[model samples]
Target: MQTAASKAPAFRAASMALPVGILTLITLMVLPIPAVMLDVFFVLNIALSVAVLMAAMNAMKPLDFSSFPSVLLFATLLRLALNVASTRVVLVSGHEGAGAAGDVIESFGQFLVGGNFAVGIFVFVILLIINMIVITKGAGRVSEVSARFTLDALPGKQMAIDSDIAAGLMTSDEAKARRAEVATEADFYGAMDGASKFVKGDAIAALLILAVNIIAGFCLGMISHGLTAAEAAESYITLAVGDALVAQVPALLLSIAAAVIVTRVTDKSDLAGHIGGQFSDPRSWMPVAVVMGALGMIPAMPQSVFLPAAAIAGYLAWHLKKRAAQPEPVAEAPPVSPDRITMEDVSDRTLITIEMGYGLVHLVDKAKGAPLVARITGVRRQLSQTFGFIVPQFRVRDSLDIDANAYRVLLGGVHIGGATIRNARVLAIDIGDVREGHAIEGEPTFDPSFGCPALWIEESERDHATAEGFLTVDPSTVIATHLDQLLSRRPDALLGPEEVRALLDTVKEDSPGLIEAIHPDPLSLSKLTRVLRALLADGISLAHPLPVLSSLALALQQTQDFEALIDRVRIDMGGWIVGKICPYGEVLPVVTLDARLESAILQGMRDPATGQPIIEPDLAGMIGERLARISADLAQRDTPANTPALVVQPPARRALNALVRARAPDCVVMALAELPTSQAVEVIAVIGAEEEQAEPQNARQEELAA
Candidate 1:
């Protein structure tokens, strides 16, 4: 047997009723409709207008009737088309009598206006003013403002969606649905802003049509049909006024509907229900009841009308007050069963986690295709290759305790770094010479990743900022870049015992004998991890584990100290390090310490009992200042082989590297023994030498350095 599901295809075809109706409306505009048909069409127009108004009243939200804008346009067109058909019949045969246009128009003109053409004309003009100036104008302004604010709030809405996904409050599909809803709302408001113009235009067109019918019909009756001026005026004026009233009434209904749709706030109840619920308060009704009762007792008032209304209001107030005094009933809960709990139910803490505020949730919402998840995956892979071990998976969640635009990164459950971003705006980083007099208008901020000066500008200004030599990035990219910087600096802490064992297990597959000979013999896995961590901390890549393992094997035979092992490995990996810093086979431009400074550093490093290099605080501060200056100057220069380097004696190289790592992390510190003999070196500048102490000394040193 055929069921509802099987008949769905036939039912679907019935959905085309609206399109068919619209086509009929257009046909009525061109073809001459019979008087009877015109009457039917006029009634249908009134019915349609009432239906639209009722729908607007019942709608829970603006988006619930997303097609209201299109429907309004079509309804206006239908009304105007009917007016055209009625006007044609009236002008061609209006001299016959008041009923020339149709029975519907004749009835409205005679019965509603008491057969007075002047009264009907006055009423039509009043309706036009109300629709054009009051309802349509106000609704249009509301739509315009709503559209602008909705577009402006789009970025914040999207960020909130992402923040929810990151916090595990919503799945990817749920987030996608919310994003689609936001876009649909913006589109609906924009269309409504334009559709409201149709109502205003229709009202103006009705007035113009009214004037044409009355003036033209009067002249045609007297001149062509041989009727007297009084007779023509009586017949034509009545019909013209009737036709205008028939169209204006329906037009007024549609205008009210449009106004209602635009102005209605999202609510769960219909218009009557909303009003009723809000008026449920006893305090509001008691004052209204007392005022009505006093008005009924006044001498001039109608006793029947005021007295009954006062009685009803007073009863309503008493009923509402009694209802308010009653206490609400509480729901009962089911009894809980006793059960045993164990430690197995809880999981261990994650190695790394990122917590974001509510506004930033959209960054990981899979529904919106947030790029942060993919970016984090890429970071893990890249860091894994650089640090010679797998980076642990990062956990992301939302925190209500933080600000909406803020996010924080944690390493082993400890807060590391984070920053706030304008999710609704793009960040434009100033890469060029951004001086004090620059005229760009925006919110001044700083780039979270690199601490560069930047501006948070509207998305519309992205192109202009790019043209002005600024790097523009979205909110997701800003967060990802900041995460990358944090992970790079803390790779040592990320490398725990589990990560070391995982790396060794993979390495054993290709070189089982090498792993067996080195591990647990002279070098333990724990000691090996420490040595690898030291190399990674200095910005060296261990993508290939073979060379590192081979160097360790030999170094372990002679010495077991991690510092000594790292220094020996650095000398063996010099070629690899050089290739990373400069082009292959290019001359290396380096800065060298003055002979006097090198001797003083060597003297400080000779004491092994201290376990770290010891120098006077003033001298150490001076050395750091000089190194930072040289590094910054080289970074700004336009040269092919100008990678900054500080070459020191072998004994003091490790000690000085540790001192400058925090102050000038970008400067590569090299021991004289680590430089390949085959590669040529140029002394670009000397730091802390006797040259700056004398006027002639500066000139002599420059000549010697070149």
Candidate 2:
């Protein structure tokens, strides 16, 4: 089966590869190199321009994909018309050259500034501008254009063009700008980092050699060739296979550089960010074209193989770089907010800081205890040191730190948390005073929403808490205050006892072990009961199990009902254990009942009819209580009875057998007659003729035997 993750990259790669392949194949086959070089370059020009148009479309406040098809079709038709015009001019000039080289040259000169070719270029430029207007007026509709191309053609790649970029796209500078965009976005350096490890330092050495060889190739062509600089540059390609080996240097560099940049950009920003940022600006990218163009000026390289090719490379690198830098203005605006700002009105150096906390760590020790660790974000990275935690924590792809503190922390647009001066630390003084830093310096401390003023605690040499100085905070106040705040936020007027009980029941189903482990003590139980009652007053019902277990245990302690409490707990736990061990649920009920009986025997039971407590009688209570106590000894919850060892008083089985077998009535039987008439009658129903009930009670007998 194909997983969702694995399918993503493949989709993205295919999208980009298709367009490049289509245009490159067409340009290579039919068009002669000299005549059609610029036209071929235009295909790349179109792709870059489209990316900018895409950026602007993205700027719209809300992103929707309704009008993608119409926009793409319009853009494609305009581009195709320009391609045909450019192609005809080149073809006509070639035929005109059939008369003579001079005639062909003249024809080319005429086509450069006027006539059919010039008219076609003019139409193409108009079409490009019109496309931009449509994008702007349509609101966010332009994004759909690029999106359609990507979804229908390129999977992961995103194209965005804003007004500024769309304007630039019509200009001749588009190609040059794109090259620079590609260079900046490229990540060959990172790939070199990974690739270096496999070969150790060998990859670095190879790159250095390649760079040297390229420069040397230029030098050799300059020094040895008798031809003029440009002609000699062309002759350089005529060298032996060994010289060809030197030509491979530039090829290797191009491949490695391209791979590195593509991989890094794809990994970090995806094709969208990489392309958007670089293509957004053109001026910053001019230097890369200068470098490639200068390199191409080296003598002795084949014109047939290198001149136009080098120029094309230069154009591409420049185009990509510029496009990535410039972002298109979206036709639509983001939803209105107090913090919103218009793009054109903003200065380049203006810095906006947003305060927040992001990374959340849930730590589980022994698989049963859950503790939480959250880092305050958007502060100085160095602040992490003072707080005694690692910096730059990342899980998945999101950095945990809040980007800014000024924005505050909003849960559903209501402020729930904020960082104070005390929670922050100064990392770099030279970076200038931040608002938070200013607060920190003036007050010496400020507490965050979730924190109180810092308390004095001795630091241990080791990182973890030690037994000697562990903090034992009374959780009642903390729990109560937080609970009250939580309930107040709810729309309901109040919670009720039954609702509280239902919440406990839900918790029991999902986290049975957690509920068992949190059994409250007497004081905690009383507080919890009050909290529940408060919830009831407020009209919310929540009778949580932790409080109930604690209350029941406390009541048992006072009423001498400890044995019954223990028995009920045994019966409850037996069902869970049997369910875990048995694949089939059939035998689980029987297992549960037997556990209850065993508990009853060991804990001992009193007959209410006689108003007397029986010990080690013909009944199973003696042994059952002993077993229940033994089971309690093996318990793992927070309850105190879960000791590692216990002493079980053996039941008097001989007396029990005699009581069932004897025809004479014993004093124990006569004692039942002294009870109230109603209770006495019920006792008779309960302790029926032992011999008659023996067959059905055999399983009960076995539990007592334990």
Candidate 3:
């Protein structure tokens, strides 16, 4: 058992480590210290500097020694404080001898400088120059540059982390840790940049203190003690030089430590390990061994030194060569029994995947600050909001089988779409009306998202391309835009039963009673999913969940037929539909069917048996062709290819919508009953006429006979 007496010293030492150390430094600066106490403090200063150097050398990375800057500050202060204490002791007692200041200083003066005051002065100045001019200056410069670059690259690093998180490659906890490490690295380098100034100032202060002590000691010695001028000079200058050397040596050690740390890369291994591994190759040693051996044989050279050095290099070269020649041992795999194979061996396929060729792999490389990952995250977020469900995480991977510049978007292991992108070039998409001559010379291709013509130009030509009225985008944006378009077109395929339940659970919070009133009775969750999928299939948004839920609940109570229920819900969602098609205070651009064609379509939908319209092939074919033509014309007139509304009577709306969806899916087919009264209509084009249907009818009959 430990007694109180045994633990008291350890406890006191632990408790006094910071506060007492600071107080002692303050006391040493303020009051004169005796030679013996000064000697002890000087020794402590040297030991602290050595400890700092060893710690710096052993650190695996800069962040591992994050407190180094503060440690450097404290060490510099301790040395300066010791300088003051020793300066006072030396100036007051230098009339006696070189040993007047302290044993540490006295020994440095007599033993290190051989008791010559001039030699001590010369050595002190040399150490001061090395610390102030070379090591400290270089370290300070490295710290400044590191801090600036770290701060400049902070945003890119943070973006990379967020992209990794969005890509599901990093967990939230891992991202948080990485962000903290980045912040610590920036702070450490910034502190070092400031802390380096302390070392420089300490060196200058040592010089000033030495000069003061020597000059003051000489005057006091001659005036008060009645000593000769030469004797006074010798005694005072010797102690002063010793004091300067004692302080400067530790300053030099710390300066070296600072340089080592600031210049160190964030490698996994320590300095020694890194150096040993780098120099391990026999090829590198062989050249040095040969050069040393040749030098050892030269006439008039110091063979005693050179031969041994050559011999050591030769031995290192031979040892390294033999080690390189040895075969690497491989571990044997454990035996597997066929009967023990399980389903766990098979990997499940991802719902969505973006596979790129080798050349385009940099678009997902975190080190390169790839913007594609972040852009894809934004696309997913926007699609989720528009489609009323969370899009699955996209898996980005590389494939060697694809073309070097090509990337494929895969949905459920099937290739949906792909595009070729130049990693070092920007795609300038022409938005119509760009003259051929004005555009720069480059590889011309169609934009993958919409098939608009685009030019692949060097990054430096981006400004010129933009000035020529082309929209400039990087490879990442091009891929993300293409993916967005593909996802937008296939919203129905993305929504499943899980997304349906999520939607219900989300809306239940706002109207819990309403959600409870309509489930499993009038409408099952499966039926609701189908209805929602139908709405999303036609470019409708489900952002307003409460309204959608309320509409669904109201419609389900009146009809058991899923088709009729969806139509009622669409009618109930007129305000939202109208708002999406036509902005507030703007008239809706609509295409109306010719009177005769409208009547035929109504007659076709009069079947009471299946609730599905079965039109004649000729009439259906004619209507599809006319609608597609009208949609194309309207798209050309609109700036961004706005969806043209095909207005019809409420009875024929469902039949007409089905007809148009099969042909021109981009057109919006709205019923007269579904149009919001607040919005006005502008008839832009007419869809069909009697004469237009006649030719298709005759051709269809001929084809059938054939």
Candidate 4:
């Protein structure tokens, strides 16, 4: 069963059809075929042409027949090759009789024109005219125009799909499908423009082949076969005309098929149904009936034919009019009740929402280009790349309850931050370098993102503010930066089990064994989510989950105690966490608790439920205050580290983390076990040591070196 399933698609009919068809077409052009085989091919050619025509008519839209161009190419080749084959036999066998080529051609030559060579010539010329001058030419022109217009509109169609995605009206999968469809439509029309040339050239080839057959057969019959003018004309001319007609009929059918394909307007119904539906309208047939009846009354017109057509038209109009007069079944207007409440009405599905007042609505409006919305989209994309998962879509909506110029960011229905904006005004933030009382006239305010002193300046004063050593930004940038500042610190608040599951599914595709070792076995989803959240709060990003999970998987081999599991993962990942802040080829500027101070904090208080250490209130306050001051000093002085990290024993890292983050959030906390020995450190500050208990300056230097 398994072998059969694996081998099924290896031997498909479509896989062999193209090669077999091409070989047959080549054989017809080069090799001589018997009359029986020639008859079979002729019937097949007629059948194939009719199939193409029916396929074109049945297509509901142009894209549904996207393969028409290639199909037309193959069909045109087959017919021309058949022409080459039939021409070979006719010139060689014309002196024998009408039956020399095959019955298909013999019947066409003898029966189609009643064995009259002149009538067959006239009939063949008429088909050439219709196929070349009418159908092929018109279809080519339509294809060229369609290709030009489609190429012109390509950029706009792509932009519209992107806009829908940014506006949150379409999902990623839906956008991909829409983009593929637009590209396919363009390619199809361009191919048709080229393919129409094949049909036109085929028609010309048919006419030239006919002329060659008649002239060559005439000369050969009289000179070589000892036949007279009347006998030669009867034998050769009839066969030449018959061969032309046989190929011409299919060529005409294909020309009509190409025209049908190019001219079709996209509709819900196929060609037959669309045309029938349009004629079913009573108003259109009423005019038709009147015109037919008027023509039938004229004596010069054929009364027998025109009168019945007029009567048939009248009956169609009357029947359509009666159907139109019958009232459609009414649905009783659905009882005019109040709209029933659904879960979507009251519950907010959006994980993050930007609710603004009426005045700030223009910031998110689509017609004005939605500057704020675009920025928000960029922020979402950047964060998703940073965090290695798609951040949920943010919803921007207007509310009457807030101040007209204010907009607020929400996470899971909880207010994160709200700030007021001065519409049309730019905020020039003072980055602590502006000289005292430099004269720049504007309204004074604090920059909402970081509380830096800023001025809401008019657009004209932008250069003046820049000259005064202030960084300038528009209203949209202010909101986006503020949102980034607030959200970048709270990644765990944004991550959930759904996001973790998505990450797991992604990693499973690349490294399945790593996931199977840790997930749904030692750690269920709920437990795994808790562990990841703790890692995120401890300053580890899931952006590169492979390394993080790789460390976790190794740790699971030792122990599954929840707290022990977290600590082991952190210790394994510590060198990475510290490398992010400290510039390369320089010592990491470190702060640590004095050995005695850490001992006191470790032994002070414990949570009764979890048995984890809690910090003494007074000591926690002193540590936060000292770390905050050291962080400020580090910012001004030259240092390898961007921020000071508090390194303590493993037991006290979490308690000190909450404490240091409260006052100086930029400062990172790490355990002594977490830091790698290869990374040299400079002990810049040490918390809680007396003049006597503290180690000497030289001793402290040696302590950091060790």
TM-score of each: 0.48, 0.19, 0.49, 0.54
CA lDDT, candidate 3, residue 547? 83
Ranking by TM-score: 4, 3, 1, 2
Query: Model 4 lDDT vs. the true structure?
Result: 0.88
CA lDDT of every candidate: 0.84, 0.34, 0.84, 0.88
Residue-pair clashes, model 2: 98
RMSD of each: 24.1, 25.8, 18.7, 18.1
Clashing pairs in 3: none
Better of 1 and 3 by TM-score: 3
Backbone clash count, each prediction separately: 4, 98, 0, 0
What TM-score does prediction 1 earn? Answer: 0.48
Query: Which candidate, 2 or 3, has the higher TM-score?
Result: 3
How would you encode candidate 3's per-residue C-alpha lDDT over 625-702 as one tens digit per residue? Answer: 877887777777743326678877776777777778878777788877777666666665555644535455344323
lDDT of 2 by residue, 197-241 (tens): 322222233334324433443455456533345443222211111
Model 1: colliding residue pairs: 162-361, 162-362, 163-361, 163-362
Give per-residue lDDT, candidate 4, residue 400.
92
In angstroms, give how far residue 208 of model 2 lies from its true place.
41
Candidate 1 on 174-277: residue-level lDDT in tens? 99899999999999999999999999999999999999999998999999998898988888888999999999988899888888888888888977788789
